[model samples]
Target: MNYCVVGTNNMTASQGFYNALFAQAGLQTVLPSERMTYWIGDDFAFATAEPFDKKPATHGNGTMVGFSVGSKEEVKKLHGLALRLGGRCEGAPHQRGPKFSAYVRDLDDNKLCFSD
Candidate 1:
């Protein structure tokens, strides 16, 4: 089955924060126009929309969204960029097994895992 995950937020500020995040991760943001933005990857896409009838979710509790890259260097670079873009490092870049990885939380407190 094919599936795509999209997050809903109450403000354009939240969506804009994600835009910068996906950019730092080297993913392209695809939007129908200017009202919504999506990060398209080889196997999945994450989109965000402004909340119309619902409020944004409270932060924390360990939900995560992960992405894989080509190398350990890329993982480190993306993690560093994420920090510079205002994301908090959930964990520093390191080898978890044979592969290197790291985690960070975006401005909205969504966890993102980067691995190689």
Candidate 2:
């Protein structure tokens, strides 16, 4: 995919949360605007922004963004980092069939998961 965009109602809080987050993963911000910020890794690029339609941004039900770190250890570290950075834990890291997974909700209530 080209990129994924998540909407934020509180830009400062959301941006701060994402800044701390992507930094831990070593993702670089490729674009920044008053209303948006984008980060790029080798595989997938994601961003957060204020909605263009002038409406309060709300989380989409049943939608989630997933990240893959290379190992279960990295998943744990990232999940911990997320919680420390104002994210709420949705699921603790664990074996899921054959993969290890963890879930969290961002400051904007966007669901995110890390897998290995």
Candidate 3:
């Protein structure tokens, strides 16, 4: 996909968490504005934003964003970092079928998966 976005009620906390997380993951920040913060890597982009409707942002049920982060070690590292940044563990790093992956819910409870 070209891009994905997750909603956040607190832009400051979300920006801080994602800034540190993406820095280590090698995504570069781009086109930041008051309502949205974006990071781009190669052909893909990711973002966090306040809701456009002026309501509280909420995580969608059964929706998740997945990243192919290159290896098991990187998967583990990002998973740990997400937790340290106030995300909750959804699943620990492990082999899931052919891919090694880990899952976490962000500060805003958006589900994310990192895989090798």
Candidate 4:
């Protein structure tokens, strides 16, 4: 079945933090609302919500949402943008043999990663 994943977090900053990261990777923002936003790519789309209480669900720990890009430069660009948008660098971008990878925390402390 076709499916999409949406994550809800207590966020003071809305989904702007995620929007910036997707934008840097040249992905389009497909649907944007006051409390939620979506990033569209060929393989999948990601949605995020800004919850009123500003707390993330307890189930998200050890879970990571990964985005795949075309090049290492795109990974670096997205990682840098995430930092500028209130995301903390969990891991800096680097080569993992054939792939470049990095991890970062969104405004709500949810871990998001990228690889190329």
Q: Rate the local accuracy (lDDT) of all candidates.
A: 0.71, 0.89, 0.93, 0.71
Report the poorest 10 consecutive residues by lDDT, candidate 3. 24-33
Clashing pairs in 4: 10-54, 10-55
| Regions of candidate 2 where Cα sits further than 4 Å from its true position | none
Q: What is the RMSD of candidate 4?
A: 3.4
Which candidate gets the maximum lDDT versus the true structure? 3
Residue-by-residue lDDT tens digits, candidate 1, 1-116: 25344454544765666776566566777776454567776676776654444566555476777777779998998898889877899999999988799998876677888999
lDDT of 3 by residue, 1-72 (tens): 679999999988998999988886678887567999899888889999898998999999999999999999
| Stretches > 4 Å off in candidate 3 | none
Q: Which has the greatest TM-score?
A: 3
Candidate 1, residue 105: the lDDT equals: 82
Tens digit of per-residue lDDT, candidate 2, span 1-116: 78899999988888788888777677888656788888888877899989998899999999999987889998998899999998999999999998999999999999999999
Q: Between candidates 2 and 3, which one is better according to lDDT? A: 3
What's the C-alpha lDDT at position 89 in model 3? 100
Clashes of 2: 0
Model 4, 1-116: lDDT tens digits are: 14345456543464566665665455667555666666666666777765546665443778887777778988998888888887899999998878899998877677888898
